[model samples]
Target: MGAPRILVVDDNKDMAQGVAMVLREAPAEVESAYTADEACARLGERAFDLVVTDVRMPGQDGMQLLDVIVERWPRSKVVMLTAYGTVQSAVEAMKRGACDYVTKPFNNEELLLVVKRALRERQLEEDLQRLQAEFEGRYVFEGLVGRDAQMLGVFDAVRKVAPSHATVLVCGEHGTGKELVARAIHRLSGRKGPFVAFSAAALPDTLIDAELFGARKGAFTGADHDRKGHFVEANDGTLFIDEVGSMPPLVQVKLLRVLQEREVLPVGSSTPTKTDARVVAATNTDLLRATREGRFRDDLYYRLSVVRVALPPLRDRIEDVPLLAEHFLSRRCSERGIAKKRLSHRATRVLLLHEWPGNVRELMNVIDRAVLFCQDDVVEPKHISFDEEATAADLSEPQSYEATKREVLERFQRLFVERLLHECDGNITEAARRAGLTRAAVHRMLKRLGIAAPHPEARRG
Candidate 1:
């Protein structure tokens, strides 16, 4: 690899040269520019491996320069330097497509590390793009983040199925990012058709049939016109059915026949539709158990599991929380103007320690909420708002059977009330109604658990 040429842009010549000196000390070539104009000028002359720019500058500020650099010289990596309390500008720089940002007076080691990593990422992206262009749509996949053994097994399965015609069966708990895996398969497959998706759990049994098998005009009312079902629409492409375990028995039978017969029989239509679609089915329920219990068809399970892929839950790959959090934070901060922020190591540790029952989806929501309301650039532990009850339940570990039983029951009751109240918007009467209890009873449980109605909307009847 050649030397990493870094362009340090600052209004002050001294500050710019100082940044350049830091980079020169490292195993990289360094250049200094006193203004954004000079930086762009250098970019036009020769492509530096990376660009380090100041946030506040005289004319044509660093952010504007960042936009130009990313647009015209996207291959050049950028690092933004901003003073304390000016994280908003740094975030804007990232949003405009800077690789990363550094706070003013950053530790020398931290700044060097961020630059090296960002350049490495850019190099990898460029390499991937080059290979993809040469190979004609072969994708290695992204989004499924984990280094756990279980997840590696899943990744291997994806690799085998991506280039083949095999349908994939992804089984995992809810919010484990099953769809992300399905999309990865589709991307790698390069089937050249639309990737159609639907959730079996989101639709009622009656509509599930029509949605998957299409419906002719006036097919039992509300079928005003001929419509293409997901299977037909996804022909030559991948059809992702989420919560496939929730699919009604009748629909499952029809879906199975489609898989076996390579065709679909639309509702209220005598003719069959050719099923040239790649099917990717995912479910949270234990399909094997369901099969033995006669709730799920064994034959269907066999077909789907021809390529079974299991995703690791968030708790399983807790080591990846910081990476995931930082990814979310960067995109979110850039989009929402929440100011650039990184999680304090302690806060990051707390996040990793919690058992993420809701998995990746839940983690993203929590991080987004924290970033949304964060008052400072660094996300501290306090901003990481989590359910005390949930954390307590996950933390209160193994003990004697009797004590465990007691704690389990207590946690359940607490979570149950909390969920009901949350669902009813903290309205005690509505929560009581949902729980089949009296308002007084709900109030007592809330009092015992120290749960307070934080919002007035939640208190409405």
Candidate 2:
């Protein structure tokens, strides 16, 4: 296509020419219209990428023309330039589908920036519409879930950053949903590139360089063909490096160079290739600590630490457990065409009370397990399982009034014999003296209570 065509509309010839000149300096060609009437005529002559119109033109003002543009060319971006700043007029212009409003005395750069951004958004929306039609809902951008205050804050941040070319660094503990956050960023970002992911731990130490930076054919053994690694393949999209903290030293150096230089020097290659993909890295380990300990490079940590977003662990945000649980349950149940299930009130209480060491991933696993084993539409407290012994025991075998009394009386007799034995090492006379009983009485109590000499290594947990 030729240079993007922009229509500049105003009643004053000088003002219209000034607006046209401003747009002409951009990566676009400008056509001037003295009035809204002329703008309508120009629209019929040829299509334009954007329309910069003064809001208060005579006869038919910018608002009336904007409605016409919306009715006829809904894809076109229209920005209203008003000399008089009226809240009512601006609001009405916005309601009528004006992309942006700029008052008189606006700087040229400000106007240009607004116009360029509006055009970019229009193009992005058009591309997204086309992609949605082409894909036919074959993909899933719906798995991410959160409703807590912090999560809402994260959502707002993601939305704002996704459309930009900024590099995002996700920091959190293991299984705190970093990948999900990355995916959300990808879906919200308007780039049409592929999403690629790689685990640092899964690659052999010797192959980290080639796996990330690609390798020429015959560069080494098992190299049958030239290759494109995650960086090249994810151009114009996202490159998600998970467990980035575990990246080997050599690879860390190279990755840092790529991030800083925006170019990749593949293994065995003389020339470096330019890459345009946005990098989003996630790590579970304390990178700062690793840097201090020399396990991770300090320079690399700071380079990748731009725009850091720390995710809260499930244990820290227990209030969201039920929301996440229900989200997972509905998703899993839908996948299998089963009736959706909800955790009972009591079961939800149990879930909230337990510590979630594994974070959102752990919550998903529990919900999956519950959905698999549960037959009814509601999951009960007994149906839930906690891998931790203390939490599990509390739910599985709660203390009853009678059971507590019986255990207390039995524990008194058992401890009396055990204490004596510990003091005497099972000598009958010494044990009886400590227990305040005869040798036969001490032996009988020990036999009745089934108490034995305690083993030091028996209770490791």
What would the per-residue lDDT of candidate 1 be over residues 144-184, giving only the tens digit for each residue? 66555566677778878988988789988888889999998
TM-scores for all candidates? 0.61, 0.55
Q: In model 1, what is the error at residue 346, expressed in angstroms? A: 2.2
Which pairs of residues collide in model 1? 425-458, 426-458
Residues 409-448 of candidate 2: C-alpha lDDT, one tens digit per residue: 4654565566666666656677777657887887677778
> lDDT scores for all predictions?
0.80, 0.79
Number of clashing pairs per prediction, in order: 2, 0
Question: Cα deviation in Å at residue 14, candidate 1?
Answer: 21
Best by lDDT: 1
TM-score of 2: 0.55
Q: Candidate 2 local accuracy as lDDT? A: 0.79
- Stretches of candidate 1 off by over 4 Å are 1-43, 48-141, 387-390, 393-461
Candidate 2 — which residues are off by over 4 angstroms?
Answer: 1-142, 388-461
**Consecutive 10-residue window with the lowest summed lDDT within model 2:** 134-143
